[model samples]
Target chain A: MDQKTAGLNIAIFFCRQLDANQDKNRRAIEKELGLRIRFFPLPCSGRIELLHLLRAIEAGADVVYLVACPEGACRYREGNLRAKRRIMFAQKLIEEIGLEGARIEMVNKTAEMPADIGAIAMELLARDAKVSISPVRSNAVASFIEK
Target chain B: MITAERKPMAEIRAMLAPYRKILVVGCGSCVAECASGGEKEVGLLASALRMDAKIEGRTIEVREMTIDRQCVYEFIDQLTGIADRYEIILSLGCGAGVQAVAEVFPKMLVIPALNTTFIGETKEPGLWVENCRACGDCKLGYFAAVCPVTRCAKGLFNGPCGGSKNGVCEVDPDSPCAWQLIIERLENAGRSDLLEAIYPPADWSRQQGKGPKKIVREDQRSEG
Candidate 1:
């Protein structure tokens, strides 16, 4: 990890169906990359709401990532599609407020090996290096790395 | 229902530039159903505005309130005590609701955040089609339920004008010709004979020839 990826606060909202061992993989990625990553597992990606994405930003997440089952693989048919639409809508809302819509991203992955989760995290960190810190990061909360 | 769209962000930001404390009032009735002004929308707008203000290095206090109906006095009265605390009331309601808020609080500065569009029906989710013009006239009996006065480009009393082609309007290919809909509906009902009587031009006096219109329903009024 370079200077930009260091101390970056990443919030990942992923579907439970995407990974069975997320906690172990999350810790492995944090230890390897020196990045502060928080994982929130949901039953399905469709359970994600517009407010969920916004609140993540409000809570000082530099980049919010959503991981869902691949298109037709959603246990609840169309759940992944619904999550895609919501991500787009949320992106539009944040963009309207002069924030970078790319700050929020969605990845579709099947239940892969534990190493794949760490790879995804690395991919996200690489992407985050290109994006600037969130302007709306609240002053009240300390950086996840600092904590 | 009365349909409306949120004003562009640039226009809204301009309207709110002077105010530090703003109350975003949404109408839960017509505007809510149309998805323009509602509780959810109010929250989204408020959040966006706050973030926008923060990004600009400005401190702004934005509050949100959504009443059941903005056009009705009983519902709009709920804002009485809270409205005075804000520097401005940014209403996401339709035009009538905005004016009603201003009228209710004569001293407070009330501004609209939405552009009142038309009286429309939800054709489907996220799609609203204008269906009524409130022309102070009822002509449905003559032209099935499809309203030509509002839907037709020319507002022809007797139509399927030469411009109509392939059952669609010449002005907008996407919109089906209103006359074609009316004729088809009438024919299906075995009322094609009604077309024999040529109707005269519509009387405009009832719609806008007179100044603002009002109806005083003595029966509904409480005794003084």
Candidate 2:
């Protein structure tokens, strides 16, 4: 990871069904990328509300991503689709408020791809090279420096 | 149910820019059912405004509250004590609900977050269609329960207008011809005879020609 990616704070919310070994995967990804990552496992991605996504950004996560089960694969039938719509809605809201909609993202993962979480982290790190730190975080830091 | 949509985010942001402490009040009745003004929506909007303020390096205090119903005085009373804490009340209720809240807190600056659209029915998930005009005159019994005043592109009392094609309205292809639906329902009910009786011009006076309408029932009110 580059210096910029190393300092990035990422939060990933995923359906528990996507990965059976979430803790192990989270640890391996963090160790390899030298990045701070928070994993929120939900019973189903449908349980994610717009507030949860926005709160993540407000809580200093430079990037918040939801990993859902592939389409037609959700045991609940449409949970993944619900999560995708909520992500899109949240993205629009943030974008309207002058934040990058790309800050929030959704990825559909199949059970076969156990290492997908690590790959997602690596991809986010590479993406960080192209984007600046979240303005919400930078503004807070600026305010603190002023004080 | 009364339907409304959240105002454009830019308009809302502009209205809120002047206030530091804001109370975003939502209604749990019609607006909530329509997904524009509900407890969850209130939270989403408040969180968004707070984040926007943060990004601008401005401090804004936003609180969220949703009453069981905003148009009723009893439900609106819930904001009495806490509302005093905020400089402005941003209501996510319908027009009636916004006015009711403003009436209760006459001194407070209450603004609407949603633009009241119409009386509608939820056709499907996330789709609400206007189906009632509240003309104060009941004519559903004659029209097989399909209201032409609201459903038809033109409120034709004597309809068919000879403008429909393939059961679709000529005015709007997306909308099915209301008169056709009425005629089909009447025929199926063996009441095609009703079509022969011409309906006289509707009394426009009963529908807003007089001004804001009011209904009072003595039996429902407590005695003085």
Candidate 3:
């Protein structure tokens, strides 16, 4: 039985170095969508290791995403890129567990793009509301057994 | 340092098929540098295996442990207390380390989760190149600090053989001719005198020609 769409849970990890002001957009998105959002403020995207991504999933997150600064925009230089590689590795690990790799993602949007952050959360929540995805890029996705 | 690459997951799963409990051991030395086996790798592999077993509707327990160097007896002895809890030890160390664990825990089943590649150095991030053969001999002083046994395709003592062109090896275009590099280094060092001094055929005894090699260091030997 699929959980109610209203209760869709998503976890977001954002780099604090990108912007010190996500509270306004985060509150607005949560209020607008009526969805559960757990926002984690990290100092740098390099701190977002694969274990954190896996642990978030294991802790009952429907979808986990990292909003990293645009490439070459990371204050620490390549912190965003490092997070991208870690998320890709996490996706591979999750795929081995029969979970869709799409469940984990790292979007390159600057802190200036709070609208994009809210938009991404909205898009993923919409996707999670429907059904768990098959590996979206795989040939076997056609055979996904939807509940 | 000794370098190794992680074995494929399918093969690792097959090896653990019969065991309910496993200890995925990692070494903090060489394999770690090569990104094959280390603390991070141990946890990653353990998590992957657990997820695989769960997804397949099976039950398996895995534990992770990484020590300074798995090839040393004292380090292997550290696992003595907890070794028997698991049915198999999936070692992520080089070949010597895997064998070392087996020798220490004579009764337990041990297996290598990495293919020990060679003695080498990291050329760049995520890129490693083999640079030594460990012939139990050191001739680096004569060859301008480059090993023909490793860099040269033929391991020829006197080289620039019938195949080098544009400074690339005949067997592998990606590799620059080792002799060319040696000559350049010699010329730069003003050690052209060393060129006419042809090195005699290296004694094969230093190599792994006979059985297992040994060094009897009476200076460092402990009294029985």
Candidate 4:
């Protein structure tokens, strides 16, 4: 709340099905939170592979969250289930690498709850109030990003 | 199919401590089907190791490669020229795969990243239970398609032990008595006559021991 999460980038990979009006809903959250979010709209939650999550972190996403359709309601039968499995596996990988497993999260929601999605971003990106530029990024790149 | 489980992370880290460069090899056959030493697992493990190295402020390089079947020389041969890039190799294949790679690259150090557990069936996704012993001598015909060598706790062939209480093993109540399964299956098949026929001791020579085993078809051989 005290501008702790001001500079950290939170990447949200949402199933496009989660919000019927993907652009408007995504932009509303982006506008509400301003520059903090970089939304990745996936056709199905199954599209969120472990490599994608790890790559996001390697690219300096301060936090990565997978917002999938509710469990039994995946548009593609069981993409959400597949996404859940990969997310769990990814969490283990992140935990071993020296980051909190909480850095990657998997939560289910329907397409209409833009506020719910925003709430998760606010809660998580805010928890680590100490978001400085990531150690892997140079001050030049960091400052460049800030600009 | 040969089955295995990834070694605990702590043990993997200890073995990996000696190498700055590592190549994690995954098998795409049995281990893949069981969800242990597959392409997905290779990525998960390699990523974990890299992250651990980054956190310690140490440099560790990990590369991942998956072969169609790590036990075959043809597929394993693909790793030949490229494998030397790393100082050590972490094979996610079953025991056979680790040895296959070792046999090919005798000069390279190949380490097993999984504990070769048993030859089993994938009862379900993420669930594996021993179903076959591959005991050269096939006894499934006599046992009504059930394998006594793998199912029986003692590998008993003749009959159920007296310790079977209500069709559960005495050694482990949670385990169903393998003989009970055979007997019930026999009764259903109307082949209880085989139950009365005593099965002599199995030929242990064909099953295990005595160095490496080989099967050669003279027709398939290129030379004498």
Candidate 5:
């Protein structure tokens, strides 16, 4: 798949524990993006690791976004802050290794604003398309076609 | 726990280009504890790979799995059958886990998904600070358990280096002088006398170097 398809093939790891009507957020995402997002609920956003974001990229996610509560607004108090820092660290690593750092993202979204989820998803999709595919990936694609 | 960050989407996509099927292996140990990598990452990788590559009849299978510990043979061996199904193994563990996977499955290509840094602790929820060097020696007993090799900006063995200003290292103003911390910890524990014991230069051979190290158990030996 090209960068556009890659952007379309997005995956989100909703670290925050879902609310009583968590399906509403999930349903909105599916309807807007036409992407099946697999949710892995965490006790708190602090539990999500930076390696999870990296491995997701390795496994073939074009855009990996984290959904957390606003800063200091986390029910667990420190969960959102931890998630934000992880996203920052992940971006730094990505930039150092010559990849577009925008592929990994973090945003604060409450259950109240389900439409914001769609906006964030679209933003991520557009952002991922802007990233230039590495020569190694291009070569891999070329070789795969030959086989 | 070791601190690490995620590999970028473009970079990871490039690494897995040659293979159609890929295994995203997560370590539920250190990396998970540090928030550097884990099983939740597997699903993220699978989606990204599917998006970045588009080809006719090209099937990219993304599988997610986690091991209790990827540093040991027992844990690595547990992936026998599941590993064979994937053309490439993307390790979300530290450098040691990636090497262990590569050593066990020489036939398959192994790729690292995280950049492992030094041993650190969660100062708070998101903040991690380097705390140990794993220098293959026990100087901590002599230094009140505050590690100079890992925390000191210069890895100083002697007293606080002259570069220390107001208990902060010159190399990084934000970094605390390890010796200062050590001394305070020692003073509080009433073990200030241990500071008088000079530390000898560490032997490089004892620490990880040159090649792989191994140990044999004679206590558990049985007659053949």
Candidate 6:
């Protein structure tokens, strides 16, 4: 769900935090950016699979930034660690296919650094501005997933 | 699990250039786990080929089909009537699936979109690593379940070769010494006696080289 109507046509869903920390992270991004940021409150960063990241890109997400907790502070032990590896893998796949992999970004922020969230949002926005997506001109997405 | 990667778009598109009618087949078993030849991958490849080829006159009809297990006969039969509609079948399955499709539709041309790699497991999501050699004789019982024949660079059946150093293979530091693991396991199990059993030199003819092997259980067979 979104709180604001973004001036920019598109924005990405940045997944971060788990359980109780989830709502707080979402509200903070909505309050600070005033941009339509899709916040996916994941159980843990470890739960964010590679298929999720690839599908997000195909689904027209302008940018996907993972806001992870400090490396050691992850309550799920290796949640942030797993997310980092999946991003690296997805990045390599994109790069190999002649596409820029910068559409996905990862940032480490503590709960106390409220401004870091805003900074990351703005950074992603600036990056998105530099990159141009050749809009998918297909009405035949109906037969897209036949398999 | 199996490890596989997508064939380069250019190469894949080039291979299907002769055929105007294409059937993109996906195997949901091995290649699916590898994230290469699954339904999603088949779709992506079909789209890329359509976009890149820009073929005209003869319509490039891509009919996508994925079988639960392309290696099995019952699953391959699912393509019955659909097989005749396409000029060429592009398989996303392993070597076995391509053969199965060809066997089922002998008249049609079959092309593989994925290079079958090895029996592997997901070291992590999207990252698959080879772990089994499928040696006719099982040795995991002797090696703490880690198959040195597969994980080792040289496939050492005995203890670590001179190439092993600091518990790592000499061929690559990233690889753990499989023999070392075997020794540690053997020592822990107090079954060091099994180590001296010098495994007889493996017979290559009995395994994959035995030609297309088939197993039929006579007891399970029924005469109609």
What's the TM-score of every candidate structure?
Answer: 0.89, 0.93, 0.83, 0.84, 0.64, 0.68
Q: Which model, 3 or 4, shows the larger DockQ?
A: 4
Q: Tens-digit lDDT track for model 6 on A65-105?
A: 67777888788888888889888876665544444577566
Residue by residue across B172-214, what tens digits does model 5's lDDT show? 9998888998888989999888777777888767678777665
Q: Compared with the true structure, what per-residue lDDT tens digits does model 5 show for residues A5-83?
A: 4423466766445444455545655674453344455667777787777655544455567877666777888888878
Checking candidate 4 for backbone clashes, the offending pairs are: A18-A111, A19-A111, A97-B51
Per-residue lDDT for A79 in model 3?
A: 90
In model 3, the runs with Cα more than 4 Å from the true position are A1-10, A23-38, A57-63, A91-101, A110-119, A127-147, B196-198
What lDDT score is found at residue A91 in candidate 3?
Answer: 88
lDDT for each candidate structure:
0.84, 0.86, 0.77, 0.80, 0.70, 0.68
Look at candidate 2 and tell me the lDDT of residue A100: 86
Better of 4 and 6 by DockQ: 4
Error (Å) of candidate 1 at residue A107 is 1.9
Fnat, 2 decimals, each candidate: 0.33, 0.79, 0.10, 0.26, 0.00, 0.00
DockQ scores of the candidates: 0.45, 0.79, 0.21, 0.31, 0.09, 0.10
lDDT of 6 by residue, B95-212 (tens): 8888988999989899888888888888876577789867676778877898978888988777778988999989989988888888878888998887787876666564676577
Which CAPRI quality tier does the interface of model 4 achieve?
acceptable
- Provide backbone clash counts, one per model: 0, 0, 0, 3, 24, 0
How well does candidate 2 reproduce the true complex, by DockQ?
Answer: 0.79
Candidate 5 regions exceeding 4 Å error are A1-147, B54-59, B191-193, B208-210, B220-224
Global lDDT for candidate 6? 0.68
List model 4 lDDT by residue over B44-124, tens digit each.
Answer: 788677656655656778899999999999999989889999999999999999999999999889999999888998787
Error of 3 at B96 (Å): 1.0
Ranking by lDDT: 2, 1, 4, 3, 5, 6
TM-score computed on alpha carbons, candidate 2: 0.93
- Model 5: interface root-mean-square deviation in Å: 8.5
**Pick by DockQ: which candidate is best?**
2
